[model samples]
Target: MEIRNPIPPFSLETALEKVQLAEDAWNSQDPIRVSLAYTIDTEWRNRSEFINGRENVVKFLSSKWQRELNYKLKKELWAFTGNRIAVRFEYEFHDIQGQWFRAYGNENWEFDDNGLMRRRFACINDLAIKEQERHIV
Candidate 1:
């Protein structure tokens, strides 16, 4: 029964805070740390993959970071309502061979009363970029 603080019925300030916190967590590239922000049975649609439960989330993120090296992410608050939020985000990452990419996406999230995200839907597109073209700053 962990309450993730800044729970539900989000105001503009709270919504922004939530989005910033999420961005920080993802940028950390720690699957276990990020998974804790979601509920035990959290559901997610990341790119074309559909994942359910926190365990799956951790596995998915672990696999992702392993493949996508030097990951950096930025998330912006798009909209919000009671227990729900929408975000637009961009992230930069490279592969083991150092092929760089920038990914742009949107996510819709629904949180439980405890403020742990129970559902997340994301749509993303990745663009190949030269290593010099990338500015993850």
Candidate 2:
């Protein structure tokens, strides 16, 4: 649980590790586990909603995955500096009606010295697609 610390000044390998770690955590779709990677006082702007603190993060993600059934995600590191990292990501999921979609997004993350994300801003767009169009396996 205490992984990916020593916040920032990342090498390419560490940056990739960070991104993959995030991707894997999210794909698990466990809100509580994902919230642990963030600071207790984390601030987040997820799409149109404003979220503050780990409790809100857990609430938001639980609601998200509940609606985004069979969610799968992939993320790539776009850039990194001192304690900030930028990422681009894609995810596929379906609604309760069984309509599939793919979502594209970018996130800017700032980490605390302990490697917990202190701030996150994300912009995302969803595109409806057929099941055959899904690329994530």
Clash numbers, per candidate? 0, 0
Local accuracy of candidate 1 as per-residue lDDT tens digits, 1-137: 78997899899999999999999999999999999999999999998899999999999999999999999998989999999999999999999998999999999999999899999999999999998898676
Query: Which has the greatest TM-score?
Result: 1
Q: lDDT of candidate 1?
A: 0.94
TM-score per candidate, chains pooled: 0.98, 0.95
Instruction: Give lDDT tens digits, candidate 2, residues 1-137.
Output: 45445457777887788888899899999999899999988999999999999999999999999999999999999999888899999999999999999999999999987788999999999999999999997
Q: After superposition, how far is residue 78 of candidate 1 from its true place, in Å?
A: 0.7
Candidate that would win on lDDT: 1
Evaluated at residue 22, the lDDT of candidate 2 is 91
